[model samples]
Target: MLVGLRAMLCIVSIVAALPAHAGTLAFPSTGSMPVLSFSATVSAGRDTAPGTALSQAFGNAGLAVSGTDCTITQDISVNGTLVPGYTNVYQTGVPGIGVRFYITAGWNGGWTDASSSQFNKTDGGTAHYTRADLVVTGPVGGGTTSNLPSMFIKFTGSCIETVTATQTLTGSTSVTGNGCSLTTPTLAFTLPRAFSKNLPSIGATTGDTTLSLGLNCPAGVKVGITVTDAVNPANRSSSLSLAPGSSAAGVGVQIVNGATLVSFGPDSAVAGTVNQWIAGTSAGGAMQVPLTARYVRTSSKLVPGSVNGKATFTMSYQ
Candidate 1:
């Protein structure tokens, strides 16, 4: 009887040294993930209010946990530069705009602002085990912005499962209006005739002509310009197609601004348009954008009679 009693005591001690099973909390695979996205052409100029909403989206971002009862928590990290004077608003990649981010979390029972670079949400409990709608705001009129801010939120908790998860969201926007008034709305380029034998081969350019675009703008206005091919508005290539009625067959026109080949886009003053290039900011006076025009051989067989191409310009201001 004494030996049996000693053996039972040893078994109980070994069982006590084993580790206990823990719970976990994480973002669901298909549902409750944050969704913040926007794309629109807002009016050009400053917003009347600092936090004017350009767009917003609602999404249910909840966590999945193990066990019937559990405790969930979140740690916040901001990956953007916060705008001055505002806690939760950050600078959009766009120059003149700001973005606001927050969530009405189930565990907190109120709106939680994601303002600081590092923070904690230990108040989470069973109230957030299932669903929570996240709110993402895209505000405009602060400056010219090219891209909306991205979101990354992480969650951890004490549930039957022991795991950590994160949620991510992305966004975008466009701005439109009359940029600076064009003083030189029309520009004409005339190229001299080139001998086919003199041209070495296709892709060689000749007759470079220098030109300038003039504009009048208000003081402190940021300016951007876009050039579009008049013959084909959708042409995004550096070479311009010859306008109809041109007798020349194997040559095309090309324009350059400050060593960069100018690609064509649709005629629009919207900010962030393709090939939009920034001219210097205005100081309440006239500005001149210098450019160069040249003719390039587009085909191996040269048929030179008369080559003409037209292009249009659109300006945007912040």
Candidate 2:
């Protein structure tokens, strides 16, 4: 009896010491439904090179991920209220939208396909399992009409079974170079006041500016950057845009995304869905992300008063 007790104690201790596979879900604002917590981790790419933002880096490197394994111990259903006609959805492998949930191999799980499907009841049929990912989709507005924030409380899709097990990451959780801040509080890109005068002709660009993003984080961690600032969110084109006030006329500004002009807003492409990053070196280095800023000439009715705008930014890491 004594020998048997000793063996049992050793086994229990071993399981207790293993890293836990647990995580959380975050909703941006109030009115969000209480989401069941899930395991979280950086992008699987992080498992590869430590600081390098793979070709999939959205902006900088750090992308917020729950983890490789996510389990929903309960049976729940949801649909979105952010917009009408387009809600309650999920898809496979980071499609830039939807709840993105799947089940994995484990005890007691049998799931139904979540493709374009809505759940109005406890998972019908036998219990199944799949790998899952609930991603941040763009809020509705301008050129985008999918996966609104309301999906948080109103989302319905694939589900995971609850089980007691250990799933430690084979990847190096060593994260570094993770602190990010805007070094340049303000950047003024130049658009010729005369360009406003051009009115519809689209005058030449007056000047340009680059905002610098400084990073310092755990060595192996990855980082990504996103621009949520735009004067007029409703007028976005996968980029940033300046809103048009009654006081100002004939011209609006647009932020440059690479060679193309992208509008600004929560739904714009400037959102941190792109997989790009400020990579770290083998020695756990640092990085500076440069954001290009310029003015796109919109409307021919150039009103040369005070041309001003602002945008807020955020950084994510895995």
Candidate 3:
């Protein structure tokens, strides 16, 4: 009688351990969901328009939808509000930027907008629900974010969802901001006519002229400047090449910022470019930069005629 009672208790315990309701929805039996990652570059700071796609990745490719009489429904909810005119798009931590996860029913089925947090039929069966695409959009922000919880899905029915790694949304974006507005007059220099004997040797310099640059900047921005040789964009040397139409030969122009001789670089605002220097931090007011330009002999002989050189100034801010 004791053995029979013990056997009955063991059967009851086994039945209790079984799942009461099996889910019909299913994911992949092996492997894991793919990670969605992105890298983007934004010029002129948040200059990109909102909703512009930056990067994309496809996930869940190996996890085909399969189940007996699969009539499952999946509801979607994102961490942020939905963007208008965009399906399944949600805002990120940064302003003016958004992301989306577009899911499909597999086969030739169309993509479904999962943004509504409503359970919709998976249309499972031989359709083989295949994959989803993740997209990042603008206006992009600066810096990086990892493992962002962008989306969550809930399904109804018996499903075999795999125990997989986190479906993290990783992003890195670079942006440059508008620093200051600049104004400067066209600079010109006239040197007294000198005899070749007086301008004796090569490397001799003459024709010093003062230049002033006016800047209207916002407060707290650290401003830097670069001079680009108009004649040769790649020139990073102290000597600026003479532009065409100049009859002069064997002489080049040079600029001195305050007292330090200034070299030229590409006409770009990228930080750390060759010869870029911090001018000062702005106090949200008008500022002036004092500069000087002079001519230097490039060769042994100085041709008598015209001397002309052009340069463009670019500003960078931190």
lDDT of 3 at 252: 84
lDDT of 3 by residue, 1-318 (tens): 455443343444434476534343444543334566655654332333344455555565343444333444555565656555665666554554566666554344666654322233433533323232323344334444333445555544454342222344656554334456776545555655655665577878777888678888767666788999998999988999999998988888889888899989888665566788878877887888888988788888779778878888887764
Compose the digit string of candidate 1's lDDT tens values, residues 162-206.
333333445345553224678888888777767886566888888
* Candidate 3 TM-score to native: 0.48
Q: List TM-scores for all candidates, in order.
A: 0.50, 0.37, 0.48
lDDT (Cα atoms) of all candidates against the true structure:
0.61, 0.36, 0.60
Ordered by lDDT, highest first, the candidates read 1, 3, 2
Give the Å shift of residue 109 in candidate 1. 15
Write the residue-wise lDDT of candidate 2 on 1-318 in tens digits: 455443343444444564443432222222222222223233222223222221110111111223324333323333333212334433212323233333322223243323322222222232223332333343211122233221111221223222222111111111111333344555555544444434447644544665555554445545544455556534334334444443565444555544545434453222245422333332245556555665545555566665666665545553
Superposition error at 190 for model 2 (Å)? 6.0
After superposition, candidate 2 runs with Cα above 4 Å error: 1-182, 185-200, 203-206, 238-248, 257-260, 267-284
- Best-performing candidate as measured by lDDT: 1
